[model samples]
Target: MHVVVIGSGIAGATCAESLAVAWRNQPEHRITLLSASPMLKTVANFHQLSRTLETFEIVERWLDDALQYPNLSIVHATVASVDTRAKSVLDTAGRRHAYDKLCVCAGARPNLIATAHPEHVIGIRDTESVKDLQARLGSARRVVVVGNGGIALELVHEVQFCDVVWAVRDEHIGTSFFDAGAATFFMSDVKLESAGMSENESTATLRHGLPEEPEETENGVAIFTPHTLQQRAAKAALASARAGVSDIPSSQAPPEPNQTAPAMEVYSGAALGPRWQDQARLHPIGERIDTPRRVVELSTSVSAVLSPAEFVAYRQQHPAIVHNDTDILDWPAIVVLSNNRVYGCDVVVSATGVVPCADFIGPEILRASDGGIAVNDQMQTNLPDVFAAGDVCTVQWPTSSHWFQLRLWTQARQMGAYAARCIQAAAKHELALLDFCFEAFAHVTRFFGFKVVLLGLYNAQGLAVGDYEVLLRVTRGHEYIKLVLANGCVQGAVLIGETDLEETFENLILNQLDVSAFKDMLLDPDVDVEDYFD
Candidate 1:
């Protein structure tokens, strides 16, 4: 039995590792891992200034174990297409590899604004893009940032030398991550002259390219390091525990060894670590003396990105237009917002979002929300003996009422491991049960220097116009908790700060417990919500 996996991202790499380990003793079962990039990424110790702006160093230690496994070989090449009928995959190099099973985890690419100039605009989706932005930011006095998600939020905090004009389509900041109330909580940080204390500036030299050649052991294990801002926080609970802090924010306890799988490695384009903002030097934009500390333009988006020629043409038509302190011809890109406003900036950061990069598998036949390939609960795609996972695939299975897809790393890791199990079961002609992870949705992330925990339909996602009641508890700059209940049952929750209610709330949503009688006391500071549920 031969299993071939395409793309060395977290999902693909994880699936490869899982399948190799599962079939390790079965030498007849051959597993081949194909990577487009030269190396893989590991979740390292992550530091944060705001929730999304983070930093970390890469580790090559993971490959030592990966290569030691028997009957597993790693290939470095980009897959071009899959001939399902022929049961084979052809790489860009024209080398054909036959497989009994194949998993596509090509991940995604930047979904930039349609009007943004290709050269003047850059999307921060991977390491290369970050380097490009860093190189461009060197002399930039001002920049226009478009997007409302993690990348945009981080950039708002990290830009010290440049004035930022943040334009969002939403009414509040971080609409992608936080609710209006929490968004307001973060807005305060935006008003501060500078966030996170600056330790004398430490220079970060971007690695030129891929690291040293893969070192091979006698056992045939190959090891190498990745060069990128590609980041996913690895140790939070452990970090807090190791630091001897008992107040586990968001009730996030580190998963036991048995529950944790090999960390997903990725090439992550334009991705930044948790500390991308806090660690940056907070140099104000001296060129723009009048620019405020921070400006958040809500309910707006970049309507157009014009080149110097286009801006010149546009200015001729609208002679009375107000302008920022920039020469329209000198700027790389000029942005026009929906409010008929034009601003010239050194460059534009299109941190909008991403779309699946499944073109390698031919025109996508199976589709899901957010341009991901739709897959059943078994992680099986419409193609026979072929599967998909990670950001490239979407869950089409009838999910638990408490769970919804969000295309996050946690889901990627789970789906990868689960996809492997489903593959194994199909290979052996046996039944495969869905992993328990699908039973509920639980996520722990940090934003604006607060531990943010999301459980179930945290933001009332996909909920129609229904009688959804909310319970709120807030303390300025300390913590915020909100619970959403539809009818009389616990449906979702948002936990910020050291609420320590993550576990209890997860159970409430998963178990569908009716908290109608106790709703008022759910967030009572003196009431032990866990004990009450217990």
Candidate 2:
């Protein structure tokens, strides 16, 4: 049996590893890992940078370490297309590699800012884009950030020294991660609420703390603090830098300097650590005054990205809020919003989500509207002998109540390992059960310096309002815990800070235990909830 796995992302790499191990003793079986980027990013710990909403980063690189298996080979090539009829894969170099089974795990791309000067925009998706962002931020004094998802959240919290004009299309912050209630909790921190500010008549919440960037202060003098995740990842990358990078990038690139973009441009795009935020300030008013912290602007969307000339014309039609006569302004580009607001900043960041790159093969491929190849429960695509996993393929199977697709690394790893088993089963004509990882959605991450564990239906996601009753606990900047119960059974929960209720609550959700009589006391401050359950 021969298997071909496309893209060396977490999905492809995991699948390749699983396959190589399974076929180690089978002399007739072969596995090939094809990648566009130079090295595979192995992610272990998952957390957003500085806990404002940034996502994750890498641990270490096993750089061609898969090659230790004689039957498994790593190929550096850009996939041109899949010839379903011939059961073969073609590369940009016109090379053809045939396969008995093929898995497409090409991930998603970043949806960049729509602007005329692609040169002035950056979408921080991969390590490459982030490095680009860090180098540029060193010289930037003001930045215009667009989007309300994970990326935007991280930036609003961590980008120090510069003024950020954060624009979103929602009524509250973090539309992608939190509801208005949870947003309220985080909003308090964003506004720098007093440690004694009265939280909701409900749950208490605690915040986490500082590390370092080995960063320079406002005076351009570098300072060192405690070791940060960024520092550790940098050291690891340097220690195991891949010998050579492939010519093709995993996604699109920013236009080179001096290039003239004729029109507004866009493309799909494509992590963090701590003290990461101390030096950085989140001043929306663009001033360093001692007044009240700025309220985060919401429900506004960028209408246009303008050059200096366009900005002047725009200011003529709709005057600037605070006029300046300086011949040279702080920003080269001006972002105009739907609310008729204008922001001038050094660079614009587009955190707008992603669309899968399922078309790396062709249109004949079965794909979801979001551009991910559609696969059945067995992880097999429409084409025979072809399967896909990870962000590149959307699972079309009937899912369990605890599971839903969220385009996360967790799902990618799960799908990849499952796909490998599916391949083995198909080759042997054997039956395989879906991995239990799909039975429930369990994720462990740290946000705002608190351990965040999300388990099955964490937000009562698909249930109608008022259908469930909520139990609450709060300790004023120490902890906030809410449990959703329906028909006396635990449905979901939102745990902030160290509540120590996750494992027991998860068990309740999975076991579907009735706790109606004890519901009111589930979150009681003095109750030993775990003991009661045990």
Candidate 3:
């Protein structure tokens, strides 16, 4: 039996690894992993925080180290197309690899804003793109950021030395993760400063980004933190020393024991998720004079991106138009917002979101309305002996009442592992039960230095209008918790900061317990909600 998997992202890597673990003793079962780039994304330091909540770090492991299993072989080449009829996939090198079973785990690409000036717009996707952005930020004085997703939120917070103009379509920031009230809670500490304002008019600038709500300290308390660069270097040195390689860089860390090293290119892999910015220096060049300014334009989007020449012409035509500085023509890109506001900046970052990479797939395979390859409950596509997982595929089957689709890393990992089990069952002509992960929606992430856990219909997704009630508990700068209740039962929740309510709430959502009698006491600080439920 031959199994072929495409892409080396979290989904592909997890699926391939799960298959190898399940069939390690079966030498006859051959597994071949095809990747466009050499780097393979692996989950490291995974911790099961609760029944449905998990947290992990995404590490870019070399392809050589990833081939830890004897029965697996990796091919490095971009996939040209898939021929479902021939049961084979053609690579860019014109070589066709035949397979008894094939799984397409090719992930999504950033869905960038349609702009006439492509060079002026940058999208954060892979390591290379991030490095490129870091290089560009060296001399930037101002930048325009577009989107309301996690990426946009992170960018607005992390970016220093350059003024940032945040253009969001939603009424409040971080609409993708938090509602207006929750958004207010997070942004409460964020000091908003208008661009091009006089020193007297501008309030004393607080921190350049959102205030950190450290778990160990109260709101106004101060704590010293270790230097991240020195810590990273120490870790790298330790790894090299353990590998018997003295003074070696972390990027050149040795392969695992008993594994043969394979030659591969660097930084050509799929998109890097989560804390990719940590790997690169995002600080702008030169010493900053004043605190960097952040302007939030709510309920607005980037209507157009003008080139330097176009911006100069427009500025000349509309001399009275409000702008940050007099020398606006120096900026490479001038972003025109939907609300008729304009800002000239060094570059425009479109952190909008991503779309599935399904163009290479043939027409025989069914696709969802969102352009993702459609798959049933078994993770199998319309065609036989073929499957799809990760961001490239969408669940077409009816999901759990509390579960819905969100193109997140956690879901990618879950779907990949579950798809492998489904594949194994299909190979033996047996039915496989749906994994419990599909029973509810669960996600763990960090935003503005606060740990965030989302479970079930956290945003009341897919629920009927006026069918659910929401409850919120906010500690100003400490934590924010929101619960969605329907029919007197907990349906979803958003737990931010060190709430310690994930386990109990996960049960509440899963068990659908009626808390009508004690609904008001759910957020009572004095009440032990967990003990009450127990």
Candidate 4:
């Protein structure tokens, strides 16, 4: 049996390694790993520059360890296309390789938005591009970043020297990861807000009158409104009208002076002025605002309602009142543009996220649907002897009718292993389809900062309100712990500034153990949760 795997990304590499292991005892099988760039050189480049450099290095080491198997052969060549009917792959060099089974894990390319300039974009699709971006950033002073994805924000942090201005259409940053309130606070700290005034209708109102003789300020530009400007205008207008009136005789005289129009009330409050307003309007959504005594406790939720009409209404109803203005002109700057162009910069990098690069397989073999390849639960496409995993294929989980897209490294690795197992089972007479379950799991542990792990679907339906439990503890400036429990087992947990027993917590989640007996103890800070696992 000859098996061919296309692409050498994490998914493709995992599939090849799994097949080699499965066929290790079977002498009849031969496995070939094909990639456009061989020698694993690209992996090294990614390790040197990307945010997950260490993670990439670990993965490379794993791949190298897997290559010790005798049945595996690594081929360096670009795959031009695949023929499902003939079960063959054509390389760019015009050489054809036949296979009994094919695993398509070509990974993805950079998904550049139409508004972005492709020339100025830097992405993680390849190692060469990352290296080039590193070189460019060495001298860049101002960078305009576009997008609200994790990579976009990560780039903002990674490029320390270059001022980053992240452009986003959304009202807040990290919408996918944080709830609106948390996101609001997070964005506030990072100075992530909407850029340039959202249309005129979206601009806030000014309740007060404009001041005469603009006050000159040192910083940027400031617009000031005098405290009594509105009152003075109203009085002058009333006096002028009264004098001009050849009063239509005593009888018609405007119902006496008692019926005079009510005086206009001018509001006096500090406001975000015109220049600052313009800055707010034009600035990107994910740029950080560094201030003295950064406060992290303030939390505000992003409103569930997000529509252009709603935005317009909010602005019309709540115009910003200008009380005072200050200059931010001296502050470090990052310029963001819709198009790809470099003005003055120390670094120019692209935050283009990954996209499906299934060009290796002909359209006849795997048709594209909704910007992705359609696949069944077995990760099998319509084409025979062909399968795909990771970002390329979609799967329907038993929990929901909606098909989920797997893009994470862990998911891709699992899918690749499953595909290899399915293929191996098919080759043998005794093959049983394995029942696989897909659950959405997202976990975050910010080193010494905070740890948050979510399992299953927190926001999904079908969950009984009382079926879940939440445990929270704040140990006075030292530690904060939170846990979400379901059916007496650990569903999720959030830990801040402490992880003494994280492994034990993780084990409880994975094993789905009954914690009913220790429910009280688990809530106690003095109690050791690890002993319960024993």
Top candidate by TM-score: 3
Estimate, for each residue in 213-323, the C-alpha lDDT of model 4 and write its tens digit: 434321222212222323433433342233221111111001122111112211111111111111222222343334311111011111111133343454355454111
Model 2 spans > 4 angstroms off: 43-57, 60-62, 65-67, 192-295, 317-329
- TM-scores of all predicted structures: 0.78, 0.78, 0.85, 0.60
Candidate 1, after superposition: displacement of residue 276 in Å?
6.8
In model 2, what is the error at residue 161, expressed in angstroms? 2.6
Arranged by lDDT, best first: 3, 1, 2, 4
User: How do the residues 1-534 of candidate 3 rate in per-residue lDDT, one tens digit apiece?
Assistant: 999999888899899989998999999888889988778988888888877778788888778877599888888878888898898989879999999999999987776777667787777777768877888788888888877788788788788677888876644567567655566566665655533344433222111122233222323222112232234334433432332222411111112121121122122356677676667778767666377878876545666788878776866776654554576667778887655568888888877776678667778889988778999999999999999999889899999998887888888888889989998999999868998888998998887778888889887777675576666667878998878888989988989899989999999999999888877778777789999888
Predicted candidate 1 versus true structure: per-residue lDDT over 1-534, tens digit per residue:
999988666677778888888988898899888877665543456343222122334332233344556778888777778888899999879999999998988777665666535677777765567767877777777688877777677787777566677766654456555565566556544453211112211000011111123332212222111111011011222322332223212211112111111122233331233444454444542353455444454445666789879887887887755555455677777887754557778778877666777766765358875568889988899888889998888788888887777666656666778899999999989758987778777767677667888777776676664356555666768887777778677788888898878778877887787777767677777777789888
RMSD of each: 15.7, 13.7, 13.5, 19.4
* Candidate 4 or 2, higher TM-score: 2
Model 3 residue 474 CA deviation (Å) reads 1.1
TM-score of 2: 0.78
Please, what are the lDDT tens digits per residue for candidate 2 over residues 169-247?
6544555454444555665456432111244311122121111243423222222222332353343233212211111
Each model's lDDT = 0.65, 0.63, 0.74, 0.46
lDDT of 3: 0.74
Specify the highest-lDDT model's number.
3
Better of 2 and 3 by TM-score: 3
